[model samples]
Target chain A: MQNTALLTVENLCVEIPTRRGILKPVDDVSLQIAPGEILGVVGESGAGKSMTGNAVIGLLDPPAHISGGQVLLNGKRVDNLPREQMRRVRGKQIGMVFQDPLTSLNPLLPIGDQLVETIQEHLPVSQREARDRAVAALDEVGIPAASSRIDSYPHEFSGGMRQRVVIALALCAEPDLVIADEPTTALDVSVQAQIISLLKKLCRERGTGVMLVTHDMGVIAEASDRVAVMYAGRLAEIGPVRQVLTDPQHPYTAGLMGSTPGASLGRRRLNQIPGTMPGLNAVPDGCAYHPRCPRAEAKCRAEPRPPVSGSASCWFPGEVKI
Target chain B: MSALVKIAGLTRIFDVSKPWLNRLLERRPKAFLKAVSDVDLQIEERTVYALVGESGSGKSTIGKVVVGLLAPSEGSVEIEGVDLHRETDAAKVDHVRSDIQMIFQSPFASLNPRWKVRDIIAEPVAARGGDTKGLSERLLEQVGLAAGDADKFPHEFSGGQRQRICIARALASNPKLIVCDEPTSALDVSVQAQVLNLMSDLQEDLGLTYLFITHDLTVVQHMADTVGVLYLGRLVEEAPRDALFERARHPYTQMLFEAAPRIDAFGREVDPPKGEIPDPINPPSGCAFHPRCPLAIERCTRERPEMRQLGPARVACHMAEP
Candidate 1:
């Protein structure tokens, strides 16, 4: 209800009608991101990180539909908007940078062409103006001599530089909210750092909020203003990035932090979260993470909804008291 | 102390360019990319040697070259002081191959879904003409997998369990050296740690050596006894794990340290590396990393830095010259 958040997802649920039954990809998720803040969404491969990002931009493809909840962008409900309106909003209001830059970028097309196309498609800009803006965007993302290199193909750029091109495309429209789904996962440590820093710097410069979907705890700790830990399409823990990442309240969050290579804990063997996330079609009866929680109780099975806490869903939660 | 494996001046060049006819028809220039350039490395018996680099830096190529999956364009590879690349001594190569198992990045891709876990693990044993049935149950149990789970397909198991199966398979051959190429990059963090810990425990218990190739610096920090930093098909630095990580002398290494996302105990400002990695085909003239090196000098542009000794560490840099 507040006008503060650039975007907010309230009890968002996504479902697909399969031959068997309704499959829930994202289940009862809710979070908020203030303008100019980076809200990190952390989870494993099927943890609904990308699903949440896709749902936010109304980019979910066929069979996948938002069955419940609301997505408010700039205090307006953007979820389930008309296709025409959604088209205008995408890449203009809520931009996206997919995981693989190569796949997302047109290999056959020059970097200049891709940028110009995105800009012209959404905005009422001339070819010359779009081309100028495209070159500038490439330069903005820290590509040296971007003006000259803008004509180069995607293959011509390194993985890190290609990712920068993707970012440049996303930010060229100067969107208020950018959803970067594992933008640097394919890059090396040094290059990953470069992309993350560049993205962060741009967000700071433009006051563009970002939803960084990744499994890397180090990234969440470094880039996010707030962290939203997800499990089985639901928010496990949502708090200030420092508190959630440093002094984690949820068992899942703690497990994630402990598993990370950066935690500075010497020789405490990496403690796994016990089991895998349940399939989207066959999620648990109650709390999704209950099947994997070492401290699960009987109530955890019957508790269908998340408990009113900082970032936990259990009958017997750990004592961080977030 | 004996070295399980020693590599000197190894390289692999991929002619990704089109055929002469195709190129001629398209009027495109012929090109060659040295994916893996000349490099030297050492692996001590029972100790893990980690090769860290970004994509296009040739870490994976080195792994392939060592495993005989791909022959090097130049240089020699010796397994237990016996040259394997010069000429494949059938008996000795078989012995070395059996003793040097590989665990790939993707647990799913590395495994055959059509085959049961038991078959997947026992394949190596069978290939090496070793007794398969004798080690099946024991190997699975040792890697923390239930003997019962071996009957199930790859899809049924969790990512952690799948990776455990990978470790089990790697151990089935009773290998002295295991080339783990991003083995845990595909699994969850806790799962990654679990696999890493298992490898460490196995190393201690069975006296196995490992060539741990990865982009995750955190994993290297936990497992490596010696670390090698590769940049554009060449090693920029090599040193004992602690020395390499704590007091990295190369500008690339120092910048890498800065760029890697770390768990901030004191909550200081994190400055990830500034620039993106350059094009590998047209890599910088002097130091491959000089393009992105903040401390790059004129000499770094004209002449390549030689790998030389500095204190107890070995570094390749003009600045590192005594």
Candidate 2:
């Protein structure tokens, strides 16, 4: 199943040139997603999870650019492609679903029109054919009365329904890879579950790869087949979801799992990761997480650590020996 | 334990209709949105009472009414045996008002960006005509923040640190109760754990009662001594933490638990809830949750079920057995 990688990110680096210095919000991060698989990217606010997704989709705004490495979609390099060419590949090859459905969708345009436009824009299909595809897309995402609701505007739909419409629009183009950044963050818990399952089902049935970026570890654990833990713009750990969640190799991953309320059921107090993630301008010299890590030693601070024996990037992998 | 806060038949209705001229022009009738309807709660002293619900479920509205941020259209909010709404004595009203504080969802939006951390924490104390000298620094240390952080602005801190400041501010007034509305929702998992732990510690040390409102079931299980589930402005279930999590009586409560993604239950397929939360403006005929409930019977759609004692919990579902 993991034979051919659908999406490969090799040493992807995203840099923001600030007034003080060049800030590497995403530095030397690498991971791969197989076809029909979900690679959950879990991280804190400034851990560059969203940046990695944006870099892959070629949507990094001005002042922030991919400084190094390549983003390959199914053996083809899309990162270094020309702007005009990359724009075409964005919808056709890699679709995007953002946190807010209201903002992602156009207010003035009806959802049916948006879906049809996206489908026709990517595939060489007629208007009638695109309309049919749009209806099917809506129906697949579990929107009730798809035919009638297709004519409704974005505002007419509820938050969850609007998200479904957005998903339909994203997949109506038949993209091979979908980059959903906090897709359910803006929704209610029950609605969040609905959207999560819909994304998983729709992507799996079509054999499309998904890069699910979120701050919630529970969401990652439930949705992703493989998990990637990020901290301070770097990959802390990446492996099978069960392994990474249960027997996390990196201290950060262990701390993350331990801190999740869902995982720490009977524990009185969650294992706190002391201090805060360093700002981009003041990132540490060696390991970015060394300052807050409990198992940090003299060696961890003095030198950089590569991805260890298995899937974690740390001087000491596996359970931390206090 | 004595009741710290008692809410009876709380209801809040907002007039969402257009103006007379606009209504005439559009040929529309008047509209009213019942944000909260006949919700009753008894919050015990020095314990955490968590209200869990999805969007438009009236959790936040209940919190606001409890904290006096918004007055209920009907019903009485009694604090320490004195009705907050009906009380005429200035001292009695002031006593209740000073004892209750609110922590908003977004730490970024809740704290004023321009104010330094010290002044922000001291604002509540100063509002009551109390001296703010060095109080911020003391509260800051109590919340596990550095005393030196007082001089720094909110923007200078991370999301977690800002949340700590918010907690410090809530503590500044020496309040007996705090209304925390989705306090940890905007935080990362590790940071959320840190905040939750801090809140728990404060509850113990200060003997504070909390009306914790959130949509996260895992968080409710982790933080609350008692849990209440709300749906479409109605309380569906209320019970002790263990009983509710282990043996949820209401169908909606069970659905919520199943819907939430758990780290321990990795790769388990989730049966997404069938329908969207019905429009709150025009809710379902009887049980607000009947449209989406799996165990919904014909009686569920015909007559509303009142909360009745069932084993260890009070459930508002006809299907639930005592």
Candidate 3:
């Protein structure tokens, strides 16, 4: 799986030197995405899903640095690249779509100019060719009257439309990898489906490897070829979406699937895991999820945290029948 | 069973027009955003009635009106047997007012950072001049928080814990109906499950009534007894939960179901929703959903459809099968 991977993250760790102590947000996480595959990274806040994405893209904020990891794009190490070189790698090779479309876009510039500039900056295209590609990109992303609407400011478009514009901007360069973090979370329920579908369509058509980071399991199930479930900065489970959703190996993944109302179906009550995911400073000595896992034993509590062996990082993997 | 809350012809309009001078200078008429249009629904005692919609669907506006946070421009909100707004008796109004409480989204913004959790929880009872002795401690334990933690400030707790604090606060008033507006949307999937489980347990134990409002259909399915689908401030469909899910008659309702990313429907190719939600200020001529609705016809564009009884649902669509 790692040999033909378009993007591979190995033993990644992101740390922030806070006043109290050093906080490891993304800890020993590894995952891969093949060309034309969408890898969904699902976890709660502080589970380091977004942090992992940022680290992979070399866009980690100051003070929070990738302390240990190897991020490879198409068999080349990009994690240790120089600042200028990393900037070139971003957008030109790995496109990013963030949670808020408004923030992702420049309020001052017209939508067309933003797309054209991004296109011209990364690709060998003339001004006129870039503008034409921008319009085509917008149209491909299902923007109506793309030529005319391209001139409008980001503020002029609605939230859903703005997201479509963001997708166009991300894919305008025809990058090999796309990193979308909670791309549809800010939109309405109806519009969420539209955006997710648009993203899936565009990525599949271009065979673009995508790392979709979101808390919503519905989205992960709907769009991902494989899923990586994170808990307390560690990868709990990573497998095919169907296998993981149906027969989750890790207790955390099972608990998460049961927590989702759609997964429970006819059950009256949601199967909630007892405790909350621990804070970075207070992650348990053993398994980080041991405090909350129903199947936690003495070994799980006393021993060092289990490493990802086969698919799940748990002492009693697949012991719990979900 | 009798209706505990009855809302009739509920409509709330907001003046969204530019400044008086700006409107005059621009030669433009005043603008109004009809947040909650003519919507009628009844909530039976000890039952959950969920209002589901997209961002601009006016679900939150309806929740505000129910909790007396906002007054309806045209309609009567009756609690038990007395109308809250139009009732002439002060004593009667005050009695009904004591029976309602609300839980808002974004627990971080809702709770006061300076205040201790105890005071935050006790505020509702204290404001009502009721005895708040040990109220916070008891409610805290009930919501799965430690009684001793009540002395800590809101910032000390995590997002899920803060939400539990919010729940404890809502329950402090000993209200009959609790209006929760996307209460768990901010939390992670696992944490969301815990909070939702707590809510469900509390509802069962206290026999409480809930006017649950959210954009997630999965949450609605698990929590609500009756479901009302809203579109652009209008109730497009209302039905019992199972019936609505089984066979949604209205095109809008069906569209929402299709658009909703579901865990069961893994990798299902969803057709991109037709068009963006029309501008609520100047919504399409007839049906507010016609522009985006797949089954919209000529009649739909010419005249607004009233809620008509279908098999087990009340659908507001001209083309719904009778």
Cα shift from native, residue B291, model 2 (Å): 1.7
Would you list the C-alpha lDDT of every candidate in the order shown? 0.84, 0.89, 0.91
Winner on DockQ (1 vs 2)? 2
Lowest lDDT block of 10, candidate 1 chain A: A313-322
Error of 2 at B314 (Å): 0.9
Model 3 steric clash pairs: none
Off by over 4 Å in 2: A1-3
Error of 3 at A294 (Å): 2.0
Compute the lDDT of residue A183 as modeled in candidate 2: 97
After the best TM-score superposition of candidate 1, give how far the Cα of residue B285 lies from its true spot, in angstroms.
3.4
Q: Residue B162 error for model 2, in Å?
A: 1.6
lDDT of 1 by residue, B1-322 (tens): 8877788888888887898999999998877888877788888888889999877788998999898889878888888777776755788766777788899898878789899888888998787576777576788899987888878899998878888898898888788888999998888786777787788889899988899998888888888889999888899999999888778989887877777887663233557676666767677798887777878889899998888999868999988643
Fnat per predicted structure, each in turn: 0.60, 0.83, 0.81
Residue pairs with clashing backbones, model 1:
none
lDDT, residue B282, candidate 1: 74
Give DockQ for candidates 1 onward, in order: 0.55, 0.80, 0.80
